[model samples]
Target: MEHEPLPSESHAEVRIVAATPEVARRVAAVLRRCFASTEQRSYPAGREGGTRLHLTLDTARAAEPARSWLATSESTDQDRTHADEV
Candidate 1:
């Protein structure tokens, strides 16, 4: 499906579907874990279809950068390292 960006960064939408409720739940759980989404609501799909889930991602919450990773190291290392190591 085509995606259009919403007017604000605080809100985002995703549609999830599966052949059965159990599978749908599993997929939704995995998505939530990976993307930190919250389920706004869900409903049964049209004929010959399974469950459909409407989820929202709170980008405002996710936008905060992790400062610990951004802090510069105070010590310089003599050992050489490859760029790919990071």
Candidate 2:
């Protein structure tokens, strides 16, 4: 598959610090869904016992979808938690 380069103006970066590899992987999965097209790198031994993940996304394509997906996820999570309490 061929990937088109994102314009410099459409690029955004994210940095995440996770305490364990499992946590880092989970964070990366969320980012992957948010930005269908992304480039990622890792900086281990970053701060104390955490690993830092650097992810770059094309904002023009990723921003709106990401926001909508996150909002939907948040609502679903809240609903699920509410159901569990009932």
Candidate 3:
């Protein structure tokens, strides 16, 4: 089946498939720390009984540490580029 694309580049659909629900939720929790996200919806992944979780993230609305981290990363990349030219 064809899935519809996200409304914009700043929005993303995240899917976490893991061997257990706890693992899936753990991953989702980590993402939630960095981005604004919808509540996760959980489903059974396969006959063997893994978990599949879905959530929507708004990248444009980054959380505290992530915003700082991204800014620092950009600066670091620029510094590296300038250094390489020297």
lDDT: which candidate is best? 3
lDDT of each: 0.62, 0.67, 0.85
Enumerate residue pairs that collide in model 2: none
Candidate 3 residues 1-86, lDDT tens each? 57676567878888888999999999999999999999899999889899999999987899988778766764434455344221
lDDT of 3 at 52: 91
- The deviation in Å at residue 16 for candidate 2 is 0.6
**What are the per-residue Cα lDDT tens digits for candidate 2 across 43-66?**
784557788787776655655567
The TM-score ranking, best first, is 3, 2, 1
Clash pairs detected, candidate 3: none
Prediction 1 global C-alpha lDDT: 0.62
Error of 1 at 20 (Å): 0.9
Write down the TM-score of every candidate.
0.53, 0.55, 0.71
Clashes of each: 0, 0, 0
Candidate 1 Cα outliers beyond 4 Å, as residue runs: 1-7, 60-86
Which 10 consecutive positions of candidate 3 have the poorest summed lDDT?
Answer: 77-86
Rank all candidate structures by their lDDT, best first, as comma-separated numbers. Answer: 3, 2, 1
